[model samples]
Target: MRSHHSLTNKAWAEFHVDGLPHVHRVFPNGESTMAIVDGLVHGDYVAAAVNDTAVTLTLFSWPASSISRYCYAIHLQIGRVEGPTGRLAVCVQVTAAREVSPVEDYWCMTVDERVALFDRGNAHPVATFRLEYENQRTVELPK
Candidate 1:
């Protein structure tokens, strides 16, 4: 068997992306998508603690600059997971679950909601997720 290592060495390193001139909309509520960025691993992101059940990267737009490449820092309750080894997954809830609309549709929300959503922070989820592990966070702590 192989040893599962906690994420103690990797981080969200830098990456570059190209955009489409025809696809201009670049927000959670926008429909215009020029390209998609996926296939990420633990060595791709740098979180503070706890290995995770999964990780994924969802890009909505071509970053304006390297400073806006995209990253996140979520607090996962690893100790609370319970399920069969055959099926362990993580469920990430996007803000305004119901109000979420199709890519071509406009989002319905108050100005404050939009402002908060666009506000810059240490973590910027690219409209979705990306798993960042090789063996996966399959630690089976005693129930």
Candidate 2:
């Protein structure tokens, strides 16, 4: 993800995705928001995470589809947010048809339900990365 940090506002970070037509912003308190850059499609924020190093967000979108008459496309975005820095870690696009309909309305589903749907193993990873935190001082021993 390409990020732009404002020199004046240390708590503000803004970034955009390559294919997606949206600009995502992360505030100082680890809250994230998105604006439609092109105004062509709509999206919704599904979940978020805050840690010592980063704040992560998950966004969901249902794009139009021609192959599946009954089902729409599923687009999942996983992004990270740190103080004045944000990154789009993973973008998952599921276009294949499913045996059972996932839900009636994605927006109506609870956060836990939405998270479960994302983790249902329908989408496979094309690549994986091993991340190491820079500020780590020690490893916790498993008791």
Candidate 3:
């Protein structure tokens, strides 16, 4: 049998009030995709930290079979690192290409209908909400 994902909703949001890990989230498509309260990742990934927060997240994989090095860095400003004594590291190292892989396995999709991937620096939406609350729908790709 396949192992189920561990990032349930409660754990992701509350960060373990009972001194344990693993989150639980539910949605209409829980069987197809998990509920992501925020953010998403694609391809092989891992996020870790020594404190309740982290110093950084790095990627050092090849683009394919090439040997070119891509230099990238991530800096975080978190409130957990201020003054705490927790020894925990939550690592999610996974990758999937399916449209639902992130939504299902990683909970990458947003629950808020207003969140978007891109913006035009305007105070409006680039896409319209024509979705029906009664059915599953396919995403419309831009040409």
Candidate 4:
């Protein structure tokens, strides 16, 4: 039987974007903000360390720069809130879900990779998360 190495590797390396961060309409017009996680380059990966274990996620994004002459597409795999500045509830909640699976998740703006090499050679932001879901500190039991 073929070893499940590939699946195992994908599990720990790729991100499962359970929810995409969205702006909250209730907040004041000026208070609301939205930024696309740029995904214009390969090897440009992001991750999130929730409890302590690193979790993988899928990535998607908008078009590349305007100077490019050829058409292009984009892909993304967001992990954590790199440096969120707006309200936590609306700005970073969805982007920071505890559990995310493909069976029960929906994302906006699915990368319509119509043109090839759209997100090529561009810089993108990344996020990381630990698996642990608590706020406990470590302490030596006894020497």
Which predicted model would earn the best lDDT?
2
Those runs of model 3 whose alpha carbons end farther than 4 Å from true positions after fitting are 1-42, 65-143
TM-score of 3: 0.19
Please write out the lDDT profile of model 4 over residues 1-143, one tens digit for every residue.
Answer: 12365322222232323333222112223232123235222222223333322233333233233332222222232233334332111112112111111212112322232112233345333443333123346898996
Residue-wise C-alpha lDDT for candidate 3, range 24-77, written one tens digit per residue: 223334332222222332122122454544432322111121232121112122
Ranking by lDDT: 2, 1, 4, 3
Clashes of each: 12, 0, 6, 30
In candidate 2 the C-alpha lDDT for residue 58 amounts to 40
Q: How close is candidate 2 to the true structure, as a TM-score?
A: 0.31
Model 1 stretches with alpha carbons more than 4 Å out: 1-52, 56-58, 61-81, 96-117, 120-143
Better of 1 and 3 by lDDT: 1
lDDT of 2: 0.40
Steric clash pairs (candidate 3): 8-23, 8-24, 9-24, 9-25, 33-104, 34-104
RMSD of 3: 19.0
Q: In terms of TM-score, which candidate is stronger, 2 or 3?
A: 2
Error of 4 at 106 (Å): 18
TM, every model:
0.20, 0.31, 0.19, 0.20
Error of 3 at 61 (Å): 3.6
Off by over 4 Å in 4: 1-52, 63-118, 124-133, 136-143
